[model samples]
Structures are given as structure tokens and as C-alpha cells.
Target chain A: MNTSSNDKQITDDLMPQKFSKSGMIWVGILSTICVIGAYAYYRQLRYGLGVTSMRDYVSWGIYISNFVFFVAISLVGSLITAIFRLANVAWSTPLTRIAEIIAVSAITFASLIIIVDMGRPERLYNLFAHGRLQSPIAWDVIVITTYLFISLFLLYVPLLPDLKIMNQQKNKNSAWQNKIYIFLGSFWKGNSEQVKISDKIINILCIMIIPVAFCIHTVTSWLFATTYRPGWDSTNFGAYFISGAFLVGAGGVIVAMYVFRKHYHLEKYITELHFEKMGRIAVMLSLIYLYFNINEYLVPAFKMKKSEAAHLAELFTGEFSIMFWFAIMVGMIIPIFIMLFKKGRKPLPMFITGIMIVVGAWFKRYLIVTPTLLHPFLPMQNVPDNYKHYFPSWEEWAITMGSLAGALLIVTFFVRIFPIIPIHETITEQNEKDHSK
Target chain B: MKKIIQNRYLLLFFVFSSMLFANRSFAQEDAGQEIVKLHYYNSNNSIQYLILESTLKKNKVFTPQKDKTYQIYLDSAGTNLIAKVKTDAAGKGKAFLPPTLKKIWDASPQHTFIVKAGDEEIISDFIITKAKITIDTLNLDGIKSIVATVFKFENNTWTPAKDVEMKVGIQRHGGVLSAGDEETYTTDSTGSVTAEFKKLNLPGNQKGDITLVAKVEENEFFGNLAAQKSVKWGVPTKVDTHFFEQRTLWTTRFKTPYWLLFMAYSIIIGVWGTLIYLVRQVIKIKKLGS
Candidate 1:
């Protein structure tokens, strides 16, 4: 296509598309899940965390696992936007907005789900009112909050130019769209100085976000690592968490990239090459995660340190053995095996690998949290017999699924306003390529 | 003014205070046997001994039990019989600290020592505590000189206890100092006296956290007093491994360490600093258009 025709095609294809029937149906289903989750949460609030099967021994059930999964998936925003940008990787540019929205949405739910875990949600203000400097819980509150805002800023700054682009396209949108654009991006002139400053700020954020991102997850790992529990006490937790987080995040992006490409029909922009690169990246991260997994289990298994023996046995051959192996196989092993092949890196196959990774990762977090709690150093006694073994009550499942649905809802709504692909960046890149030709 | 006041401890007999408690209900009354007056004795915490004094009340007047044998049960739960002794002509019988005392101590902080002869019985209620030595607060210095005190309660007022042999030592990481520094020395007539621990061992914390414990071993009066005070002495010599000094990393206590404070503030400053600047940049963008 010629230059102006190409511009027209790109704008039409890449601008925020309307929700199709399936999209509305997807929205409806997600909303229904969220409403059910909200009701479950209301019941939890009325009855307390007792509505969930979590007890004194296995106190942190699925809610913590879900929170961790959200935090883990949120790392992708940093991987794609910050790490890739700093590395000067060009191919990921079109996918930045999608990745960041996922980060922001996942983090929002990560924050919310943790509160849902708190028996007294009203006590959250106590974190600020009597916030201690030494507690890992306090460290988490600080870093996660910092990560959220930085992630928001990172999401917002790049979208200014695109927001301005949508603003000028009077024929394409409604008055509501115009109002949102004016409220968020009316100041954007696309002037050289403004772009210059925006780019500088982006560079600063990309650099600054890297450590904060590492800290948020590493400190989260410390929440478990710092404890004396059999499975959680490890020097290897930080790297282990970060690596798994990257794999899950990469998997999430591949899934999003596929959906956006197929649904919006933007094959030319989000191409086969992107999926292939992401697959390779996912495999690399999974390998790194696999190494940590071996270290996390093997050395401890080698010692059988009396404390860790039961926990390791449960993971190896007991009740959790099945889920444990499944998480390892599907989350890490199977994804690694699949993505190793050229065929597997194809969009359709890659999408399946992404699903496997994301699902497996969620179970992996559940294993990380719940199993160790069941195997405390002391005998699990005095608590009700049910406390000895944790099975998530229906309310827990609903609320966990709801928090997930809520995160997806945020991503869904973000796409409705902001372009899933960056319009201004895409056009500029295309213009640059055309000029060079 | 609470002056030096005849050393640290003043023993006072508070019959008036005991009289103030009127119309109290007790479980059972002695059938002619006066309640056992239990006195725990120790000199420099060397030997722990319990002295039991029982007087025969004949026609509601105090009289010596002469040579009657009374069995003293240790725990209030009545599970263990600690000692059997014959009362002296002066109305006193005695027993040493038994190994079972620790087991009974674990269950209840307050111990009920029961003395019985035939149908007549007398019970004494007492609390066991670590004997602690206190020094006026002073800065850490080598060759530290200090004094500690013990008091007895009798005659309605706390008076300086006499003949209290307080074992003075520091609590080590492990191993009890039951002997060696076990020599018995009586507290002065004023109930307040000083013991100089020459060649004192310093617990390596440059800012000392070592507690000097003064244990008044088995005494005829006071059961046991384990008083301890945190002292900074001898330029603390132990190296602390914790990066944050607020509380050791292993502790369950919630304390904000200087390192964490620095970390939280540093990130907050870096992040919020950049964000405020970015917000200003956004504001500048609006002004550029207007």
C-alpha cells in the first residue's frame, strides 16, 4: 500500500476497536464472575475469612496464591516495557501498551486480593497509621504501592501521543471518547520539546522501575523466605520468583498479542516474528525458572533437614505431589519442550503454551504458599482436623476467580479506551521505515 | 524522697495490710496447726533450700510444734510430695530445692507449699522469681564497680532483710552459674549491700545488653528473688550480625530498623521524586498549549 493509504489502513486497524459480540459476551461472563466474586467477598466480610477453608495452620490459602499469581503476571509490564526498552529491542514496541495494561490491571488486583485475604480489611489503614519500618509485610506494602504508581505512570506517559491522535480523529469516536481524551491527553501538542521530555521521563522510569520491580517480587519472596517454614526458608527464593514471574509475564503477553492480532486483524503489525521471539524468551525464562526449581527442591531434599523432610515428601509423593508435578510439567517443563520447536512458536501453538504457562504458574504459586504452611516445624495439632489439610472452600474459589476476572475486566476496559497497539509509535516507525526505503 | 534507704530492699511485716483484706474466703482451715511459714534460703544462689516453720496453735495462741513430723507437698495441684521433715523445737522444719520444682514451676508461677501433720494442715502461697541485682545506671566502662540489694517483708513494713545470701552473676548464652561464684554471703544488717564481681565477663555487645542477675538463693524469709537489670559494662565486646540494630532479624518483634527506614525512604524519594517531576512536566505541557 502507498503512504497515505498505508496510514489510513494502520489507523483503522490499530485504533481501539469496538467490542464485538464475542467481546461483549466475554465482558458479560467476566462481569458475572466478578459480581459473584463480589457476593462471595460480601459473605466473607459478613462471616469473616472463616467462610474460606483456611485455618490457623494453613492460614494463607488460595487468596494469597491468587495475589502472588497477580503479582507474578504483573511483572510482564516491566519485562516488555522497561527491560525491552532499555535493551533497545525494537520488535516489542507495538506490544508495549498491551503489556503495561496487563501489569497495571494485575497489580490493581494483587493489591485488592491481599486486602480480601486480610480478615479485617478496615485495618489496612493501620499499615499507614502505625507502619513499622522493619516488617517484610511493611516492605511489601511499600514496594507494591510504588510499583503500582510507576507502572501507572509508565502506562500513561506513552499513551499521551496516542490519546492526542484519538482526540483529532473526530469521525471515529463518540463525545464520551472526546471527553476522556481531553481529560487525559488534551495537553499533548506532540511538540518536539514535549516529546523530548516525555522520552526522557520514559527512559528514567524504565531504569528506575527495574530495581523496584525486582524488589517488589524479591521482597514478596522474602515474605516466605524470611520465615522458618520448611519449604519457604530458602536463599534461592528471590531469583526463583523473578524468573518464574518473567516466564508467566511473557506467556501472558503472547496470549494477549495473539488475541489482539486475531481479533483486531492487525497481522501486519503484530506478526509471526513477535510470537516466535516471545516463545524463545518464554523458554529462556522457564529454563532459568527450572534451574531455581531444582535448587529450591534438590538441595533441601539432599539434606532432609528433619523440618523440610515432610514438606519435600508431600511435594514428591504425597497429596500435593500431583499438583506440584503438574505445575512443574505444564508451567515449566511442557512449555519449555513446546517452545523449543519451530512449530510451537507459531501463534496458535504459542497461545496454547501461554495458557499452559499461565495456568501452571497459578498452581505453582498455590503450592509455594499452602504446602509449607501445612508443614510447620511444630506438629499441626490443637487446630481442627480439617486445618491439618487445606481445601479451598467455594467462597475462596469464587473470590479468587473474581479477583482474576476483575483484573481481566480492567484490561478489557482499558482496551476500550486506549488503543491496544500504540498508534503514534506504530505510525512513526512505519513512516521512518518508509522514509528509509 | 526515696533515698538510699538502708540499701535496696526493706523488709516490712504488713499485718495491717493483711488485716485490710476483710472477710476473705479460703479453701480450708488448719485444725489447730498454724499455716506453714515457708522461707526460701540461698547464699550467692549457691544452694537452694526451703525452710518450713510450723507452730502449734493451742487454744488460739501460738506454740512450738516441738518434734512433730509434717509432710510438705510442693505443687498446689497436689501431684508431688517434695519433702518430709520433723519440726524443730523452735517450730521449724526444712527441705532443699528438688528437681521436681522446675516441673511444678512450669505449670504455675505461684506455688502453693502445703505442710500437713495428721488432720491438721497449713498452706503457704508464694511466687518464685529470679533474683536480680540492680546498679545505678552508668555508662559502659572497664573495671566496673557496682552494688546490689535485697529486702525482707515483716512487721507491717519492708525492712532491710538480714542474712540474705544473694548470688551475683550474669546470664550466659547457656550454662547456669549454680556453683563457683556459689559462696554464701549475707546481705548487710540494712538489707542493702554491695558485691564487687572482679574480672567480670563482658557479653561482646559494644552497647551492652547483658543482664546482671542477683539471685537470693534459699532464704528463711524470701522464697526466691531473681532480679536483673540491663547493664552497659566493659565496652561491650560481642559483634552483632544483624544489619539493622533495631531488633535482631530473627525476632518476632515488629521494629523498623534504620536500614529498612533508609530503604523505604530511598525508594519513596526516588519514585515520588520522579513522579512529582513528571506531573510538573504534564502541567508544563498544558501551559504550552494555553
Candidate 2:
């Protein structure tokens, strides 16, 4: 009777809970923002990209930058769930599910924002119907789709046992919850043979995902590096992008772990040790990204080629300087300084640094995309004066914010139905410890 | 419901009343006032000036309600201070333009100047022409540099062209009809200009032949003129002799190695094949309990 009660208590604590009033209000606000964004996008679709401030010179703007940011942050799922698992690291198990969810949501929106960036999004299907395999865009579409499915599988495979557990507590959960669990994972029996097969499948997926993840981000960096633009034309872009991506992704995971821990009151499961480990990881990644940043800028500045000089000047001391400095300090440097200290690795301070890294990384993407485009080799001439400079219009701001809110809403709904922290995995770990003792 | 209907009726009454009063004020502000507007008048014969004569469009348009002071000025690069003229109530004004202004103009001898009155401005143009241009290719021996002698009809006869710039180009013989970049060269005191070109500057026929051309395009002052001569350049035009061997990242042509294509296909097949298999395995698990 005592063992059964303890199991029931564990089940209740790990099960997906109903949304509190605050959660409902948060969802409502996000939905409203999404609706507004949808309306703004509809206007853009009707009127064409002309409604946005993007013109001939600054053809690629916030949309491309946002897409890059999404792709960058999406890399964390592979870093945490796949790489860690393949490395046989045990500490990352509790955080795996959060990382995977972020990857799925971010990549989904990464694909969406790309469609939004296109002038004729209706013709997006044409990429498949009469596509040229030679195009870089075709390559991106292929890899992102592959990465998305792999991410989804990585997310879903782990949730099966949890889904099965949810299906068991017949009376405790609502009818909708029971139906979802059944539809998703009624096949999960938790038998030794089944567990053996599941473990083998997960191990294979974890191994398979590492290269696919690298390919997705490497191809994304090639989209810019292949261009003739001075800032984008560099051998360092792929490694630079990958490193920066890992840093921001780790930052994102830290941010999410803190939120899920505090809000869901899963402090017992997501302990301070996870924060310390993640904080150390974040610092290391920030340092790697910082090195790449130096290589990306320093080598170019040394040459000061006539074409590259203008672009470097713009980033160094001209109009984009403020954003450049902000991104460097808040995104990489400050977080590095803070996370280096033991005291700074505490959850609250790490959360603050995580948010800073994320926000700074977004502007860093902006700095990467827009400033380079503004300094094309040919001088800007014979265009409208407004085309001389770029600032995101109200419609752009609304759509960008809306896309962000939409991603959050996805994570929100995901947590509402599925466990943010993996219940079955936690239980398995607890069982293993007891047996070992 | 009854009170709401009463309030709606009251709102409609005020709305209708306000519109009526608004229309009355709009009509009062209009006041049947007519102002004389300005227009441009073209002059066929003029030597030293561009004329601007304002004409009224409507029958009662030119009220001449007061002095209604008008100003006549040439709009040179928008400086708006070239020259002005006075008109005595006849609404007539003339703007004098410089003959050798050298302001960059379109490919037209006629240039437009403007006249501004109280609220209206009129544009009028006059003809400004340059001396006749004549070009001739000089150096027939050397293919490295082209020397073309140009002369202008000034002071009644042919003279060495001074301060006249012309473009030198080569019409390519290979492939479709196209020309190389036209290098601009200004005539020296001797009216002879030389264009320096690298060896094989323009593509030629199988016999290494190409045509050199010297041209002066129609500018604000000079009408267009061109002269051409044949020259045998260096090597034969490059063909697709080694296209297959030359591999570059930019080209999408299939490589003999077939490695990239094979690798891409393998990754696609392997990843998606494994994915489909995993999904099927998940489905097969449902049969386990049954």
C-alpha cells in the first residue's frame, strides 16, 4: 500500500496539469498579439513586400535576421539532447525535453518566417513542383525539413512512456487528456523488450541527429557566405554561425529551464546543479563564439580592402556601432563575466544572463544581415532617399513580434498538454538509483 | 429600447444638422474667387535666352486682383537664382539663359527654365547647340592602343577638338552581337585621343580579327558621331574547350566525380528512409499488445 501510494504521488506530480488563471491570461494575450500579426501579414500579402520598409538596397531585412535567429536557437536541441546523450552524459536528461521542444518550435517558425520573407509566398510550392536542385534555397528547404522531422522524432520518442503513463490514470485526467495520451502513445507497454527496443531506437536517433543538425546550420550559413557581399563573404561564416548558434541555444535552454522549474515548481527535479552545469556550458560556448567573432572581424579589418572598409567602419564606429557593441557586450562578454563566477551560476542570475544573451543575439543577427546589405560594393545612388537608410516599419515590427509570440504560444500549448520535463525518464532514473543502492 | 431609439434619433438629427452647417461654411469660404494661374510659352527663334510667358487657362482665371508680384528665374540644379525678368500687368516675363553653362543636361539641345508667380510656376525652354563633331580612327598599325582624331566645326571651319570627350570601344566578332566597355577619353590640344587596351581586349573571329570604334554620343552640346576601323588583335576568342575540366562551386554542371550528388542523395535517402522506418516501427508497436 505504501509503495503504491508513493507511485501515485509521483505520477500526480509528473502529470500535465491544468492551466492556472495566469496561464490562461498569458495565452490570451499571446493569441491577441498573434491575431494582430496575422492581420499585419495579410496586409503585407495583399499589398506585397512594398508595405515594408525593405526596398531595392536593403532587400533582406528583419525577416531574414529573425529566420537566422530561429535557426540559431534551434541548434540547442541537438546540443543538449543528442550530443549529450551520445556523450553518455547523465546530467542533461531532465533538460532534454525542454531543449527538444525549443528546437521544434524554433525550426517551425524559422520555416514560417522564411515564407513570410518571400515576395510571392504562394509560389513556395513551386520550389517542389518545378524546383531546380541546383539552387541554394532548394538545399536549405531540404535540410530544414529533414532537421524538423528529426527534431520532432527526437521530441516524440521520449514522450511515449510519459504518454503511456498519462493514459493509465483513468479518472485523474480529463477526457481530452486521456484521448491525446492514447492517440499518441497507447502502444507503449513499458515491458522489458519494449524498453530495450525503445532504448536502441533512441540511441540510433541521437547518433543520427548530430550530423543532420550540423548540416542544417552549416547550409544555413552557406546561404550568406555564398553571396558576394563583403561582410558575408568569409570562410569563417560557417564556424562562426555554428558557434554563435550553440551559445545562443544554450542560453535559450537555460532561460527555459529556469522558467519551467520555477513556474511548474519542479525545483526538486530541475535542481541547482543543472543550472551550474548549464552555466559552465554557456560560458564555454560564449568564449568559442567570441573567438569566432574576433576571426570574422579582425582578419577583415587587417586588410581594410576598399570594399570591406566601409562595412567594417559601419560596424566599428558608424551607424551600426551601437547595436554591434550591445550585441558583443550583453550577448557574449557580460554573460561570460557573470557566468564565470560561482555565485553568478545561481538560477536567478543565470536567468537574467540567459535573457540578455538571447535578446543580444537577436540584434547580433540583425547586425549581421542588415549592415552588410546596406554597404553593397556599388554605391547607393539614384534611389529614393529613404532607400539610403533602413528602419523597420510598424508592419515589420508587428509581424516580427507576432512571430515571436506565436513561437512562445506553441511552447505554451505544448506544456499545457505534455510534460515540460520528461516524467518517464525521471522515474526511470529514480528506479535505477534505488536498484543500485 | 424606446429610450435607445429616442437617443439614436437625437444623434441622427445632430449629424444631419452639422453637415448642412458645414456645407454652408464651405461654400462661404470658396467665395467665387478666381486667381490668374501661370503657364509656359515656347519661342521658336532665340539665340541667347530661354523665354517664359505665362498664359491663363480659364476665361476668368486671370483676375489680376492685385499686383500679384511674379518672379522669373532659371531653375539651374534647383539653385533658383540664375536670372529674373519684370512683367507689366501683361503677365509677360522672359528668363535669360547662359550659352556655355556646362550644366549637365539630357541628350537634348533644348533646356527648360522656369517662372514663378504668387502660387504658380511655368516652364519654358530654348535651344542650345554645340559645334558639329567629326571622328576618324588614326593608328592602323598598333592593336595595343587606339588613336582617333576628332575635329569640331567651330569659327566657320574644321579645328582640333578641345575639351571634347569621346568613347572608344571594340565590337566583338565572337558569339552574339556585343561590344566591350566604351572607354572615355578626352581630346588633347591636338584633337587626337588615344585609348589604351590590354592584349585581346575584345573577342575576335577564328582568324583573330576585331573592329575598333571611336564614338562621341549626343550630349547637351554635341550631336553623336562614330568612326570604326578593323584591327587584328592577339589570341583567338576562348571557346568551351576545357569547360568540363574546370570545376567551380558556382557552376551547377555535373562533375565526373559525382561525389557531391551521390552524398546528397545518400543523406536524403538514409535520413528519410530511416525516418519512415522509425514511424512504421512505432505503428507496428501498436500490434504488440493486441
| Best model per DockQ | 1
Per-residue lDDT tens digits for candidate 1, residues B9-57, read 3422355445545324221243465546777654453465667777767
lDDT (10s digit) by residue, model 2, range B1-290: 99999999999999999999999998776555543333322221122333333344343454333333455444352454545555446655444544434453323334444445544654434223433333333344564567766664455466677667777667544321223244477789988877655534445766667766666654445444566666666356667747656544445444423565677788899989988888776666666644
Q: What is the TM-score of chain A alone in each candidate?
A: 0.99, 0.98
DockQ, candidate no. 2: 0.19
Who wins the lDDT comparison?
1
Candidate 2 residues lying further than 4 Å off, grouped into runs, are A1-3, B1-257
lDDT tens digits, residue span A67-101, model 1:
89999999999999999999989899988988999
What docking tier does model 1 reach?
acceptable
Docking class of 2: incorrect
Candidate 1 wrongly placed segments (more than 4 Å): B1-255
First chain TM-score, candidate 2:
0.98
Cα error of candidate 1 at position A377, Å: 0.8
The candidate maximizing TM-score is: 2
